[model samples]
Target: MAISAPLNTALRAFAMLLFVVAIAACSRTPNAMPTGVGNLGPGGGAPGSQQEFLVSVGDRVFFETDSSNLTPTAMATLDKQAAWLNQYSNYRIMIEGHADERGTREYNIALGARRASIVVNYLTSKGVNGQRITSQSFGKERPVAICNDISCWSQNRRAVTVVQ
Candidate 1:
């Protein structure tokens, strides 16, 4: 059976109203938490959470396999983060580089070093003082997540931004 235009229009309006009400009922602000930073995996962070890290004393950030390039998306993400770092010049930032479990320890260390240096270089270009930023290589020593798939690999491959 075909519905009349008026009834169909009313039904759609009611459905839209329910959705808006449901979303409004569910929305709430999250409580702030201290940045354990890399001590805790990314879980440690809530969406939109900003945690400060000191680059001194060795910050731990990881990278992907044999690559020093930050992905375009990573660069965009880092740009906002770098802006924050630049805001607080007193705080030092150490970007720690890490690799996956598949490589030799030494090889991973070199790759991790490259990853951290790349971040430092980018930060320098962005007007962040080189003296305020430094880097270290954890190589494959730390794994935020460990699994045989890309999901696990992605977390393991990171450069942590530490502030002190």
Candidate 2:
């Protein structure tokens, strides 16, 4: 369903708040911020190791329908990521929460937050340090596409686990 304009506005505002907070969280070096926020890939990896954090093998997780609770699939994904993090103890990460463009904007933003936190909690439970994982919700702001179809909407409802 298309979102109501009021809800959309609220969600946009929440997303803006989250964007600002995320920017501030990674504001250590002026140069480091862009690498993390703009390029969700391996932009911050060591030289010649740009592909290090590209979510290769198992680095992120996708959620089921409208729930923030992780399914077995998501659990498995995080288990792999947890193992990866354990293998590389010094690695840090940023869990970006996103929502598909199918619900009220504010509600979607809240759902996104819950989803990201779920992943964060799962990782921490599996031995990854909580401090190293920062969660942010983008609601439906920066969609990869603007289509209203279910195909596009399903893809939009996701939480991307990017390395820092």
Q: Which candidate should be chosen as best, given TM-score against the real structure?
A: 2
lDDT for residue 110 in candidate 1, whole number 0-100 = 92
Q: What is the C-alpha lDDT of each candidate?
A: 0.72, 0.76
lDDT of 2 by residue, 1-164 (tens): 99999999999999999999999988665554444324543444443232554534355566666878787887878887787777777767888888887778998899889989999998999999887889899888867657878777777777778777
Give each prediction's root-mean-square deviation over alpha carbons.
Answer: 10.1, 16.9
Candidate 1 lDDT over 1-64, as tens digits, reads: 9999999999999999999998987763355333445554343433323442332222344345
Candidate 2 displacement at residue 23 in angstroms: 44
What's the CA error at residue 131 for candidate 1, in Å?
0.5
TM-score of 1: 0.63
lDDT of 1 at 102: 76
What lDDT score goes with residue 87 in model 1? 69
Q: After superposition, how far is residue 69 of candidate 2 from its true place, in Å?
A: 1.6
